[model samples]
Every structure is written in structure tokens, then in C-alpha cells.
Target: MDENEKDRILKVEIDVSGKLHLTPEKKKFTLIYRTATEVHWNTEINTLYSPKPRDWTYLEWFKHIIKVTKEECYCELNITEQTEWVNIPNELKKEITKAQQWL
Candidate 1:
């Protein structure tokens, strides 16, 4: 599996009836959020326009469960948090630029 596709942000989906839906076989998990935005505002609210609403989406990806073992103990995890970051090394950046014909 592609390492990039192995990771994705997770969120819980709860119905109006106050029940959670989860399935490990389908890589579906749940996360409870305390608060969220109900609307959005533009850079300048000079015009008479209602604020843009907020839309939350869950990313679909296969989850990989790995077990970490040390001489002292073992740790098990079923859920993983996808971090938002990509730091390319200086040499890699140069290669990417050349490949894209920007250099």
C-alpha cells in the first residue's frame, strides 16, 4: 500500500438518534468533537450576504494497525491520527523543481 494513502484524518459519524457507527473492517472509526463551526465569514462583510456555511468531510483510506514492541513492553493501537505536514529535504526540493520544469 502507498504510504501516503495509508494515513488520513479520522472523525466520528453519529446519527441524529445519538448512536455511533464504526467498523474496523471498513477502516471506519469514531471521534467525538466537543465543538465545531456552524458558519464562515468572508474577508470583508461589507455586502449583504449570509456567511458561507461550513462543511466537514471524512477522508476514506485503508488503515494499518502496527504493534510497537520494546524490551520492556508492547503497545497496541487501533486508531491513528494523520498529521498534516510534508517536509522535503533540500535536495529533494531541487529534484522536484527540475522534474516540474520550474528550475
Candidate 2:
């Protein structure tokens, strides 16, 4: 990514309500916000930044959950009653893999 893109990503804001506000370049959508939630770490990272689950970090897990929540928010039909928690979709695993590259 270019410097401009990196800067944009760095500027992402979390409002008082704990929502990530991202505005992608050249995207028609003006405001793309995702709710931010706490992610628990199974194992703490050592001084070298290594953990038992090397591939999955707290930020990665947060991104995965946020993406799923965004999709649910955009769903047309509400098949089930809305709840405080969400069910992470299996397909999101693929997306999480792709996100790891950029993140």
C-alpha cells in the first residue's frame, strides 16, 4: 500500500460508542463503521511478540468479529431475533486469512 493508504488506515477512529470509523479511498460509501469489542487473549505475547497461537492475534480476532457484525447489520431479512452477541460465520475464516496479509 502507498503512504497515503497507510496514513488513512492509521487515521481510523473509534468513537465514544466504540465503533471503528473507516473511509476507504474512492469508495462510494462515505461512512463505514464497525462496532469494536474487547478480545481476550488465550495466551499473552512474550517479549519477542510470540504466542502459542502465532497465527491468531487479538486484533485479528477483533477484525473478524467486526466484519461479521457489519454483514449482519446489512442483512435484508432478520430471520432470528436480534441479540447482543453474534454468530461468527465460517466463511469469515477465509476473509480473515486475506485480512492478515494487509493487517
Candidate 3:
């Protein structure tokens, strides 16, 4: 992976209001965004999923329920920096390197 791409500022708009409105059994945390390259996606999943359209109500199956009901979520990336070189973890570096090798 290019060092320049590490800190690429991607926009992700997550709408959790629907899930929060559902009953415990009927509702769960689901990914509101679907475009892998558009929004930062988990490369771990193999299938290419459709981008969650604006009018679409239910979320894609790829999305999983949030394990915790807690209000605080730290998983959201800290994107205050304008520089194009975010520090990534060693595991992600390995994954990025591996992906780059195929190119």
C-alpha cells in the first residue's frame, strides 16, 4: 500500500437511529454505508456488497449487530489530521502490504 493512501480521508455517514429504534430482537447495529472503496471497509469480508442506497431501509446482511449497547463507540476513526499518512497498526500494515504485493 502506498504510504500516501494510509491517511486518505474517507467520508462515512452512519445512521444508527433506525437500529436504536427497534426492539432488541428485531433490531441490531448494521452498516449504513456499503461501498467498500467509498467508505473504509473491512477487507476481511470476501463478497462484494451493494452500496446502501439512499432510500433503502433495511441494512445489508454483511452488517452485524453491535455487541454492546453502550453509547460510546471508539471504533470511529479520529480524522482531525489533514496529513495523508495516518498511523496504522502492524496487522493492517501486513494486510496492506500483502494486498500491494498482488499488484
Give per-residue CA lDDT, model 2, range 62-103, as digits (tens).
Answer: 464344333433311111122122232445434543563543
Candidate 2 TM-score, C-alpha based? 0.25
Query: Which pairs in model 3 have colliding backbones?
Result: none
Give me the runs in candidate 2 sitting further than 4 Å from their true place. Answer: 1-10, 30-62, 65-103
> How well does model 2 score by local distance difference test?
0.29
- lDDT by residue (8-103, candidate 1, tens digit) is 223222234422222222222121111121111112321111122133221111111121111111222123333211232455334333432311
Every model's Cα RMSD, please?
17.9, 16.3, 16.5
C-alpha TM-scores of all predictions:
0.18, 0.25, 0.20
Best by TM-score: 2
Clash count in backbone of candidate 1: 0
Question: How many clashes show up per model?
Answer: 0, 0, 0
lDDT of 2 at 83: 15
Deviation of model 3 at 102, angstroms: 1.1
Report clash pairs, candidate 2: none
